[model samples]
Target: MWLPQPVHALPERLAQLIWGWALAWWRIVYLGAVVLVLVLSPSSYSRVGRHLLARRMYLDTLPILLGFTALAALLSLIITRIVVVTALSYGLSRYALEMVIRVLVLELIPLTAAMFVAMRCAIPSGAQLAQLRRSGRLVVLERTGADPVRMELLPRVVAAGFASVTLAALSCVVALAMAYFSVFGLGTAGLVSFTRMFGHVFSPEVTLVFVLKTVFFSLAIAVIPMTAGMYDLGASERRSELGGLARMFAVLLLIELVSLVGNYY
Candidate 1:
């Protein structure tokens, strides 16, 4: 069913705005679907939607992940050079690296990356989706005897999730390498301690929890945007954006709280 997707008056600024939204939608669906499968298996029929989502994600998310990783690496390095180094110069260097890694790399970096990615790409995606539905695209599909839910939206949700997870993993790898150089200055002396510290910080259970937390963060990022987009299909457009983000962020915070609790537990 092809719904009436009208051609709007696309002004340059609004067009740019719409483009951002479009990018967000694709990433949110692509990335979100992959991560969701990792979380739980839906019904067999959902697999087709997942494949579509995965395909979109494969085409779109990989390049974004690489770009984001590069950008994040640069940001982490700048922070380390200034904040971490300054602390060290003040004779507080002994505690600098671990603290930096904990705050900037492990905890803060991942959250920041997810949120930034969501806002940068997912929010716009959500809005466009809402507009698509409003334009009667969903109804059009129904008339054509097609499933709008699985065929149209599910793939998008999956893509958003996939983008988030892939980007996070890429950023983490960059952070790990940067952490070593930030502390040890490209020397081998820090590898032993770094490995030990890493091992201590991320044990079996801890590692599991960490992975879970990231997945939630990724899911929230995707789910919120998609929810917002879909909700708009049924509500007033003026205030319907980011419906999923609100719920997603709340859950993301809860997951963080849980992670902290378990870590200190």
Candidate 2:
């Protein structure tokens, strides 16, 4: 049976897609194992190591995160105003709060926070880690039983995750306030209605899902670049370090798409 060339290539394409997904899953599994080990090992939390590394990571990343948060606030305010105005025009004012909560807080803020950390913090840290590995410093540390993964990687991951959560929380708060002001102005006139609407929008289930999604986003931003960088540690060919970053963003987009489907559908 003769078939069109495109149709004949369909199965091969499907196979390639499936294979790519399988490799991604494998990488995810490997990352999960690394996280599990970090969690289960008490020494991964050595107070001095963790504290010093965490302080360095947070201090180094804070300025960037704050700058990103400011930009996010501007964009969020615009979006909130638009949503509020559009809803009022359509006689859907009652749904405005819920729409803002679900769209901005549940969806936009977390993803933005993750990408901000990934670009501004994680990629550079990964490149540094890769460079250290290439220079044989990591091997020396490992030989001395210094457990660089615990003393080094875990703290950065924890700090990056903390930064992501902090940024997301801050952005969400800013957006919520902006949404209220957009809808009801700065006066106390709408306080009661605003509180009621906020409570209704952030029901237990909605709150839980938002928290879970934020945690997943934070962890993804922290872990993906580190793992990707480590995976390519020994490659003979020196490609651009941004290759890991490109892969990290691809994974992030997939995560965001899944979150959207789960939230809306």
Candidate 3:
């Protein structure tokens, strides 16, 4: 039986979509491997390399750190107050601190920090890299015997990773403090109970999961956009940006889901 043309083309379209997706992921993995190798190679960090890394790190980290910290503090204050009030109203005051810590420090802060870095630094850096590649600047550097990956991409990747981790850590501290003040006021009356609850919430297994999740989030934020930008797939610049952002969000969501299962299930 002869099928309609549209029906016959359906499978082809699906296959093409699958292939494109696989190719994009493969590029990400390959680029990540190259970056890891460069990072581990001491020869990649000569005096000039160190200067590039330091300058890029400063550019990536300092502009956003204070603003992000302030925003995290405000968000922590609001969330802590709400959780404490709700828990108190429900006669679940004892669980309030635990919930706040798990929800904010262990989960939300890291994800928020990753997203913030992605928006503030990673995506823009990727876009700039794409522009440079498109304009043949990367090729020019390559022709000059320069390792563009070492001089250009590595700094951005390392800086984004550091910024994400630093932001998450600082935000988590702010959140913990805000939660304590929200529940305990301006006194040390609840200090003993708070310490006990904090310890209970951050058991070894939970702490391990938290750390791993934050690291994965930072890695995704650091790597995905650059991969998309560096390896163009016959897409327009706008399309590339949108596609990279979507992929990055999907990976972040997957990491969050895995962490949630590890923690709760």
Candidate 4:
């Protein structure tokens, strides 16, 4: 007797799922190799590469990163005030500094910075790269003996990584200052106490985790969209662009979830 349709399809579906995961893993490995080659090649630091890097840094990264960092600072100031006021109202005023440090510096600021770069920079850059690839421009450049990965992709990824770290660091400083001011006002009276609290909260272990989390956030913001753009199954530029963004954001969220689990649990 012939099997039922559902049973007949089950093996095929399982095979398809397994194949998809294999392809995904292969893409990740290829992306990692591309990044490693770009970073390790001495030719990547040539004058032309330096010019490209500067252009990406000044034109593409700095302006938007600064504007977003400022916006994050304002939002952080508001949040700091709220946290401080709530802690005071709850008779948990002693924990206010620690709460601000944990929430703002250790978590929110880096995530916000990564998301900002992803939305404003990474997706658009990936879309443009996909469009160029769809138009065969990258292949044309390759035919000229120029590595498009080095010439075209490296600067953008490097700039994005730098922007992520810069924005996160600056926003953390702003948030810390705001937290201090919000809790203790402008007087010098609480300076010693604030220093003590900051030191206590940023023990070596917590500091190490914060550094690693920021590094991972920057790498994710820089690398994921480019990888998706290069590897997604879509042929059309429009479809590739959308697919890249979807995959990039999904990866970012997964990284964030992992960070949360590691930090809290």
Q: Which candidate wins on TM-score?
A: 3
The TM-score obtained by model 4 is: 0.89
lDDT of 1 by residue, 1-265 (tens): 9875445644666887787567555655664565456446465246666677678677547657777888888877887778677886799876676666666666776787678668766666767777878788888988898767666666666667777777877787798788779767878988998888777767788778778878778777766676655644344345445434555676778888898787668
How many backbone clashes does every candidate have? 32, 0, 0, 0
The model with the greater TM-score, 2 or 3, is 3
Per-residue lDDT over 1-265 for candidate 3, one digit per residue giving the tens place of the 0 to 100 score: 9956788799999998898778778888898899889989999789999999999989999999999999999998999889889999999988988999999999899999999999999999998888888888889999999988887899999999989999999989988888888888989999999999999999999999999999989889999999866865565557767877899999999999999999999
lDDT of 4 at 8: 77
Q: Rank the candidates by TM-score, best first.
A: 3, 4, 2, 1
lDDT of 2 by residue, 118-214 (tens): 7777767776776777677878989998877776667767778788888889888887887777777889899998888788878787777788878
Error of 1 at 253 (Å): 2.9
Q: lDDT per prediction?
A: 0.70, 0.75, 0.90, 0.79
Off by over 4 Å in 3: 1-5, 235-237
Task: Please list all clashing residue pairs in model 2, or write none if there are none.
Answer: none
Lowest lDDT block of 10, candidate 4: 235-244
Q: List pairs with backbone clashes in candidate 3.
A: none
Tell me, by lDDT, which candidate is best. Answer: 3
Error of 2 at 76 (Å): 2.1
Ranking by lDDT: 3, 4, 2, 1
The deviation in Å at residue 192 for candidate 2 is 1.6
Please give the lDDT score at residue 3 for candidate 1.
Answer: 75
